[model samples]
Target: MAKQFPEISPALQEFILRQRVFFTASAATTGRVNVSPRGTDMLRVLGPNAVVYLDLTGSGNETAAHLRATGRLTVMFCAFEGAPMILRLYGAGRVLRRGGPDYARLLATEYGGTEPLGARQMVLLDIDLVQTSCGFGVPLFDHAGERPTLARWAEAKEKQEGLEAYRRQKNTRSIDGLPTGLFEEDPVPVG
Candidate 1:
């Protein structure tokens, strides 16, 4: 049976911390829903009702664009090598860019004052619902190691031109013509 709670409990937090990967979903008011797989030790549980994850530079800025249009977001984690279970966090989230105060504060607090190579922005999820379900059908899989290609690419690009230049070319707009708020001089305010 699936169970839902108001917020994450201590036990639930433990499970969340151990997950090797998670998926984030978001959608604009009318466009397609974007679901992206995210991994790396890039997430942190801030409180019983809040969590944050470091979002690296990606091909599409769908999540940030979607959140700018609609605050709805869902983060899901499934056990591939553990007790059979699935966890979902439903929340409203905001994107904080690298230059923002909230981003700096959170980074310092949770991440020990250093940023990742392709650090883009941090997505904060103010979770309102935590759900757990039996994952009896979720196939088991073994863990591999993290991929270094992204970091290598980001490093090479930064060394060649600059991070801002790449962001301007690739990260400025979502596929749906929505602004990503990346590299913006005066970014659009979050609604």
Candidate 2:
């Protein structure tokens, strides 16, 4: 069975909170589509129609670059432990650079002004569609806890070249050569 909703219902929000991982999909008008697995407790549901995730430094900045080229983004969550359900949120998303207005507001209100290590930017999605489907075929798995590898890497990198420099070197462009807007935006250090 499948269902669609105009906004995120309370039940859906609870389901989202319970999940330890989610996937993000994005693409420009041309080139390869990007789908990436994300975790690390960086996402927040602000309201029925809005959600945001802290974008950490990674091998590539495809999502930000794709969002800059095209506002469309999709986030998906699946029930791997409990009920058999899959959720998808479709929306127009935008990148909130480190010093941007939306980023500042969200950081203060939702994040308590604490920016984690390796945080490059924030992606805010104004959701327009919410869909849920049966995940009966999906295999069940136990939660093994989040990995500390990324945090440790970020700490070491911050101690070395600094996150900003790393972002400049690796996160400025998508694999298909689209600008991620990181270079154009002047990001101030978050205290």
Candidate 3:
């Protein structure tokens, strides 16, 4: 059976915290929808109805562009190891750049205790709906270690060229030419 909630319940929060992977989906008002898998230690629950994730540098900035264009987002997490369940958070989100006030506050609150990673942006979601479905068909899999490539790349680029160049060259416009923040000065890069 499926269930719905107005916000992330306590049980849902526990499940979310235990999950090692999740997926994010977004789209502009017209262009193709993007669904991307996310993992690592980059996700955080901010409140019962809010969450944030560090957006690492990637080949495309579809999520950021889509949010800028439509502000709609969906984050889904499937239980592949424990119970058979899938949780989906439907919400609107905003992007925070490295130097912005929100960015500085979030970074200080969430990760300032540790050395900074070369995270380019942060996607802060204000969840409006929480839905769960029986994921009976989801396959169980053994947990593997995290991939070190992205962190390595980001670390290597830290204080170097930065991700701005990459964002400018590859993330300036969505596939549909939606006006993303890429062209603006100190534009926020998407994950």
Candidate 4:
């Protein structure tokens, strides 16, 4: 059976805290939808209705662009080790870049430290609905611990020159040519 809750409860938050990975899905008015697997200690639950996750620099910035275009976002989490549950959060999302107004605030409030080296922005979701279902079909697997490859890669990038040069080259647009707002309000060059 499935259940819908008005807001995330403490128990639900605990479950989220236990999760090592989650998926973020979003799309714009036109173009392919983006579903990204996110991990590491970047996600944080802020109060009952809002959740914020630090977005690291990646090959593409589809999520930021999608949110900028549509504001629709869905987050999904499945219990793979302990319980048999799948949780979905439906919400409106916003992208706050590294130097944006709320960016530092969230880093101080939710993260309690300086912005990480590879952190490009913060994706904040104002959750509207929470749904949970029995994940009977989800396979169970033991937790193997977090992978350090991404951090190592990002550190290497930072050491090279920083994200600006890389963002200019790779993250400026989605595969479908949708603008990702990577340069804030800079002009989108024709590639």
TM-score winner: 1
Clashes of 4: 0
The better candidate by TM-score, 1 or 2, is 1
**Alpha carbon lDDT at 116, candidate 3:** 44
lDDT of each: 0.89, 0.90, 0.83, 0.87
Q: Rank the candidates by lDDT, best first.
A: 2, 1, 4, 3
Prediction 4 TM-score vs. true: 0.93
Better of 2 and 3 by TM-score: 2
User: Scored by Cα lDDT, where does model 3 land?
Assistant: 0.83
lDDT of 1 by residue, 46-136 (tens): 9999999999987778999888888899999999987999999999998998968999999999999999888999999999999999999
How well is each residue in 1-191 modelled by candidate 3, as lDDT tens digits?
Answer: 88989999888999999899999999887869999999837888998999998887777878888998789999999998988999999999888865678878888888764534656678999999999999999999989788889888877765678766766776767777765684447355455
lDDT string for model 2 (6-53, tens) is 999999999999999999999999999999999828999999999999
lDDT at residue 160 of model 2 (Cα atoms)? 94
Q: Which segments of model 4 are wrong by more than 4 Å?
A: 187-191
Judged by lDDT, which candidate is best?
2
Pairs with steric clashes in candidate 1 = none
> Candidate 1: minimum summed lDDT over ten consecutive residues — where?
182-191
